[model samples]
Target: MNSAQLKIHLLCRGIQLDSSVDLDADARPILRTRGGLASGIEGILPGGLSINIPVYESFAADSPFSLVKKEEKYYVFRDEEELSEIVLPPNPKFYSKKTSSGKLMSRIGVMQGTYLGIYPTDICEFWKTDPPSNCRFCSVGLNLGSTEDIDKTDADLLETTLAAMQEEKITFVHFNAGYLGGKELEILEHYIELIKKNTPLMVGLQAAPSADYSIYERLKKKGVDHLSFCIELFDEERLKEVCPGKSRTIGRKQYLDTIEACSKIFMRGRVSGEIIAGLEPAEKTIEAIDYFAKMGVVSTVCIFRPLIGTQYENLPSPKPEDMIPIFQHLYRTTLYNRIPLGMAPNIKVSIVMLAEEGRGLIEKKGFRLRLCEMRNSFIKFFISLYFKIRIRYGKIRLGL
Candidate 1:
């Protein structure tokens, strides 16, 4: 089916299918969505957007679309009619490797499309706060110690990162940690420095805004190519209600200020502020997109999934019809401001809304989208060229 419809279905009701770990139908060593909600695996849609659909015990048994494996290949079927061929990203070659300390390489990181994703720390301080202020929609607290080691070493990160680069040809790595305050930044920097020293992958950090803004400068010095502050909601009151710990500590003003400041340091598409759409008024989300675009930062939006076991698990996801306009607004705002649609093929991750908009830019070819694409391509080309030169010549040697 169409990109919008497919994305909406995946966001609202994950597909009801299952993959065997031992079979090619199973795309293992892949990123799990929404803190391992026992749904679908992350994969590339036929149109080239990264998506994770429901496959195991999904709520949408009645959904017209179902994933089926026929002769080792996976296909999306609509009532016994094939809709599209699906590509399950293969298990990375690095998954079999072990570090010097004998840690499984796959345990250190997982591939989300082409980007190697590492969760530096799963423990969030907010879980232990006197008032229990973790974000209502987040599952980081529930996942602590259950999925990954609470503390990982730099050696583990460095070895795992280089293996991904060498074996899987990954050019980017994203490090995520729940709120550990300054300690979180330290964990990220530790890995960033190690990975930059050992491999050529472009690094991205997802963490809370540091209390000291100067941490941004330090991270840049350590070779963090990109940064994201996940301010999940935009409206001041709703943000406080939904993300009590984040709003209490960083707040909307501080989040925006940090995003703006990091945008100045990283410039344009390199800095991103994550907004969870369908949580607040769509207009507020639109307003947040506008604000991020004007400052030349990527406004990465994820459709609100009421992930199981979280405080808001019972709340329903927003209607797919409602999210269509929000995605359209995001497209227009980012295009008008001349920011890139995504970080490019390898560096981008599978967030549904961004993928839908990227699909629109490719398929729709409307005047505004075409112009935005031209601008986006122009910028992306230069960025790619700059990195190419730096990799070969030891620095950017061009005068332009």
Candidate 2:
């Protein structure tokens, strides 16, 4: 099977760990994200397909696929047949270093794939309410304060990012916050500015959509490179049932309107509308991909992983067959709309199958799509080189 199919299968039907495997010594230390995915082993398959395979989920214990080490080399097997050699993300040496404020850099910002993912605020307010309106599929409240530090200072964040850039050679820093009563942008703006003025690293943010669209323009003007709004599910009724706090406080229309407004502000492929694929039907997920593509926003889909402490913990994970069509549509819709993709240099996300990586899932390509692919490949080279040069220069000069 191709890498894309392998990715889907491993994600759906998780792999088991052989007795010979010592994850603590060999793998990226699994940190359960408050975003509720990616609490697993970070492995890269052939052709640069990076994935965070489910290692902690209950379903992983009874899988056909398994991992074992041979002569210090990592390999994944399916039913006692070796399928492919696996490459693990090297555990960062800088994780042991500390910030100027005496906080461990790893506690301040953790690497999610190639980017530095920092949650710079306290818990989402939904989880703090008396009734607790947190999303049924989210584990933000459960994971925060226990797994990582909360309310990190801006100085602490900058110190951590610098350590990561200097040691790990990172190109991007992503800052996301929980709902701050409409002040997420306000609270994060200073942190964003410090990174923009001090480093050439590309900046990205994800939070609930702002009530005021002008805040997004301010963020863009401050050199924020990308912005994503998590809408969770496309079916409004299902969304209401699943994300009660969001639906009651911020209507579904607000997410769409905010996404459309920001799409025009940021260039195409710079804005994304995020949705979970398995919670709603595949058709709904396809509709969302089409909707985002039309609005000049790339759709970021996360397959629903039933995180251990979330309300949906007892629920079943989505099957691989069920998810193949959803991601296949992501490739088609993004390309059909002429959105530039695979332009960011070395931003490989382990948690989800990237839209660009979906190229492997398609069996046939039409002549028009072939032309589009060629154009994108050509664009990717120059654009990536530009960033590479900027990053190299920035390491010495320090700003874009």
Candidate 3:
């Protein structure tokens, strides 16, 4: 297989064999068995490509690939043949330190590619409710009392963020929390302001869409550069079944409206709706991508891997081949709508497919792919001109 194709295959299939850990290597402790299974080895390849693949436990031992270390260098091998030289992302210097509140810096925030991911809240409120509502595929609810700490103060977050920026050169911060209410937004706003005021890093926040539209404005004012709502399903019935709390509270229309409204406020390419690839049918997933793309919202696809502790733990992961068409559809739709892939540079992370990889696959096979690239170029140029004019003249007030 070609290199791009092989990497995509491995990402979807997951690495089979594992690598030994060296605590003395001065790398970030690879977190295993956490909320999203965000802990794993960061694999760097040719063409500046990188991915955060799971190497913990079964994910390492059950897949078709392996990451082996020899002579202090990491390489990815498939069926005993080396594909490319790789590097495990370095552990941030701040991770070894402690926040002012005595919280371990690593506990406060974890690195996801170029972005520092901070989960401010440990558990989803829906899971805490008597009826106990949560996304069936989510592991956050399962991790609440065990792996995650419930109380992470704003001060702890700020101190950790500052250290990450200074030591790791991370320019982006993604603030995530479970299904908390306005209180979560308030907390996020406070942290956003603190980080914006103190450092040059841009910040992003992902949470349930609030019923109040004004909260979006407040968030933008707080200097949140990008915003996201994790509406994991697109099919009406499936959404209700998969995300009971969201369905019962806001309903599908409100969720869609919230995303559209956020896009209006955040502008095209700045807002995203996260949808898992495996939970629903491929057609519905493609439809969601089209729907979001038309609204100028980027679709962040999280390939469904059944984390061990979640409700769907027994469900098999979608085959790597199954994702090819889904990703192709996403790439074509986003290009048609002129929305850029990925949040920013150096920010490729595990949960979503990198836009570059998708574009590479599309470009490698010319035909309609060539047409898509031409259209993408035209759309990109016009969009760039629009933004430049908007900024240069300051003709309109964005309140940002």
Q: Quick one: best lDDT, which candidate?
A: 2
Q: Residues 205-294, candidate 2: write the lDDT tens digits.
A: 998888688898889889998998999989999999999998888879999999999999999999988899889889999999999999
Task: TM-score for candidate 3, please give it.
Answer: 0.86
Clashes of each: 2, 0, 3
> What is the Cα-based lDDT of residue 1 in candidate 2?
82
> What RMSD value applies to candidate 3?
5.0
Arrange candidates by lDDT, descending: 2, 3, 1
Candidate 3 per-residue lDDT over residues 1-400, each given as its tens digit:
6556665676666775444535347345666423364445665666656676755435456787876777887777887788877676677788778888887877777777667887776577777777777777777776544544567887888788867766666667888877675467776777788777766566898877776889889888777888877888899899899889878876788779889999988878889888888889999989999999998998888787666666776677777788888887777778667776543435666545755467656645657656766766666677556544533333123221
Model 3, residue 300: distance off in Å is 0.2
Off by over 4 Å in 1: 18-25, 29-39, 56-58, 343-345, 359-366, 385-400
Considering summed lDDT, which 10 consecutive residues are worst modelled in model 2?
Answer: 391-400
Q: Candidate 1 has which clashing residue pairs, if any?
A: 15-54, 17-55
The TM-score, computed over Cα atoms with residue i paired to residue i, of candidate 1 is 0.88
Q: Give the Å shift of residue 284 in candidate 2.
A: 0.4
Worst 10 residues of 3 by lDDT: 391-400
Report the Cα lDDT for candidate 1: 0.70
User: Cα lDDT of model 3 overall?
Assistant: 0.71
**RMSD, candidate 1, Å:** 4.1
TM-score of each: 0.88, 0.97, 0.86
- Candidate 2 pairs with clashing backbones: none
